[model samples]
Target chain A: MTQLSIDQIQAGDELPTLSVDVTPTTVVLGALASRDWRPMHHDKDFAVNRNGTRDIFLNTPNQAAWFERYVTDWTGATGRLGKMQFRMRDSVFPGDTMVIRGKVTNVSTDDSGCAWADLDLAMTVNDKITTSCKARVAVPSGSGDNPWKRRGSDWQPNGPGNSNAKANGS
Target chain B: MIEIPNEVGDWIGQPRYEEDTEFDVERGYIHTTCSSVENGNPLFWDDKVANELTDGPIAPPTMLSVWFRPHHWAPGRKKQAQPLQIHFDLKEKLGLPEAIMTDNTMTFGEPVRPGDRLKTRQILRSVSEPKTTKLGQGRFWEIEVEYTNQRGEMVGIESYTGFGYRRGA
Candidate 1:
């Protein structure tokens, strides 16, 4: 388990990096997970012919996940995502290994002592930035207690509540 | 050449409204990829956790991207796309020589769970005349979409900036 305090977090703190090979299978499967039946997202030939795309590209949902991973992984289990924003600069296609990165750009505390941070984020493929954004994450305050932690009463360890639940099988 | 009137151009930029639109969130492979990329655990798919955690089936925070899964883009439109993307379909169908996605921004809020019927409203933000570029002059417009969930709670907002260029302009 990772431990972090808002008082320890400051602007310019580097968030962890997530490197993944963006494959067509993953992209296509993602569409299924969301029940998004848009053929262009899965069928490369159909997309190239019908949608004028060069090849299968990452959808908005995929980009959003990338942003979430960037924030939560560092903030720990209790860290809840508050707000996230991303701009698609280029297409992410099959066989592309993207390096998603972020850094703490600013940190502040609300009147209620909620530790809020601004993160500068980017996803790079082939050394090119394909997606970039600024995200805000709500962290536990300096008091060393996260009010949201107790709410995980329903969270089942090693169960579906964990985003890494599938990795166990793989 | 078909020269669209300046008034029509203005109209394209003019803000319009979209309301009472309902969409759903479901579980599928997209969740898997999202999980892998984000290092999420199985609980995201654990129906038990979802039902117990949020008092309903919860979708990933990114569910907004797929909220339109059960709905059509527009009632009578042939091509399908995000509501914001479809806003420019009229220009595309008219054989407009050039349109490029100029800018886009999305601000996310609450996580949209399954069983949450979302309503999205849109407003025309701004439209600008053809601005000179190295390639040629291009027209631009901006539109905003405000989304509210079934609880009449604000979920998120999206702003789309689109630009179209005349062929060889």
Candidate 2:
């Protein structure tokens, strides 16, 4: 597994532009996995005639999950998500390609061996930003130790302690 | 005219019991067909990278948006009342006004990897009064759902915003 130290990432460092296609099947599977029963996401005619939507757009939860994935993928197991905020701008249809872009805006280290980075994120389809967000992550300071040794190492079971684990060193 | 229910707010936030969600590696791959249709990029298609990010081939980034809702695939779960339709019908019964979709946004979280079972906790976030628009009388509301995996991890949050308008003469 490849891991980058929080220190290695700079304020201007750009996270990879990950892209995914949004399709009816994508929308349906997301809704199914999410238990979202709203018809506009799945119903074409309803969106076109009733909602005046160009096409079914990606839902908010799915967008949030993607943003999380983008950060986690970069931070690996050593980083914890602290806060995230984003706005849905344009509508994304099934056939549109969704691209995620992120830039490291701030980096700091606390008394503990935790490193923090604030990121500016945007998801665009066909050159239009459909979602823009900001997220803060707490990552291990590395303490000059090998990062690969700790891949998926710090993850605790989801509970009161889980949030604590991220807050501890960061 | 539809009669307004005295306790309309009570009905809005009634929590629907969450249902079980399951996923198989193959099923997850099959689910990615939507990504292909959307002209998805190779990042999602690369098996090695996907495994690194999700521990296995995961669904497309937006796969959950369309899949989790109670539908023909999961019949037992569908037995529960549909919230959107119920609200629509109730509004008519109460002679309440119409709603519309003004705008909405979503923030992505961790990748919903393959074989992850998620449970959705639904909530009625808020209902705002009619906002004056040039075309009509528009009212809006935000419906939010927090999705948690079997591990009790907050995988994502979904919020839907809708607006309603008065009929034209």
Candidate 3:
């Protein structure tokens, strides 16, 4: 896997678009893997009749996993996620094509010397956004710097220069 | 018109439930999750590659809650564990027939690895006033879950918001 160095990232960088044909299996497997046994996520009859939805839909944790995969795929194996948050406006159902896209909002090294990148991502199905995300990830400063190796005071997820700080400030 | 019971307010800002995962973080579960998402990040698959960063192959940060989810059935256990008790409580208390999650935020801490047991504490943060929306009439509520490893180190936190409402009041 090609690791993304912090220097190569910019405030306006666009990640490669990811589109997938969401099927029933896609929704069910994701729910199962996340250990979400909620009937709304796997039982179509329950979702449609009981939950008042069209069909079974992706669970919250499942959507979170997709967001993590999308961000990590771009940052590569070494990238470490500090924080991820999203708002779900609608449900993702089977047979809809889900598209995920992201843009870098900022890049900077923190007081502890940890390189970080802030991202804005969205998940859309059939041209309508189902979820939107904001994420903070730590990327390597260079070939020799691994953000994953940072520990103790070195890895301050809520400190200055991180997304949590921005969220708090807002 | 919907009315949130006075007792609902008492649930806010309180630790609702504290429970441990049914099983430890396992490698097979991680692999299954990766396959489901089609995530090929080597850190979740290759131990050597992950050891370069942390102690060993690490579970994906998104899988924080998966470890805390209770099993569907266990021998000698008469009642099933409800990991999300607050959600159900609000539904019953408010007389809402249906519910949907509106948003979620997760802050990650220590990397979760294989063989690690995790515990979670659920806390109700806030509940909104009754409001009308395209979906229906309901109130929005937020809950937070803090996850810790066997060593008592913080692993992550999930702040989740959901709407409980009547289908067509």
How well does candidate 2 score on lDDT at residue A35? 57
Write candidate 1's Cα lDDT for A93-145 as tens digits.
88899888888988876544556677899889988999888776666675556
Q: What is the DockQ (computed on Cα atoms) for candidate 3?
A: 0.56
Top candidate by lDDT: 3
Per-chain TM-score of candidate 1, chain B: 0.65
Fraction of true interface contacts that also occur in model 1 = 0.33
In the range A75-163, model 2's lDDT, one tens digit per residue, is: 75444565566676666788888889999998876443446788999889887887788787766566554221222224221222234
Off by over 4 Å in 2: A16-44, A59-83, A94-99, A109-114, A125-127, A143-170, B1-5, B11-68, B73-120, B133-136, B144-169
- The positional error of residue B19 in candidate 3, measured at the CA in angstroms, is 1.8
Model 2, span B1-169: residue lDDT tens: 2233545566577655465544422354433443334323333566775554345555543444443444445556645555344435444544445554434433234445666777765565555554655435555566665566566655555566765555441
Q: lDDT rank, highest first?
A: 3, 1, 2
- Provide the lDDT at A13 for model 1: 85
Q: After superposition, how far is residue B124 of candidate 3 from its true place, in Å?
A: 0.6
- Scoring only the A-chain of each prediction against the true A-chain gives TM-scores of 0.81, 0.79, 0.92
lDDT of 2: 0.57
Compare candidates 2 and 3 on lDDT and give the better one. 3
Ten residues in sequence with the least summed lDDT for candidate 2 chain A:
A148-157
As a TM-score, model 2 comes out at: 0.59
DockQ of 1: 0.17
Query: lDDT per model, in order?
Result: 0.60, 0.57, 0.86
Write the residue-wise lDDT of candidate 1 on B1-169 in tens digits: 3355555555554445455544455455336656546556333655674454344455555556456444545587776545454445535633454554545555545556656677765565655654765434666667666666776655566666666655555
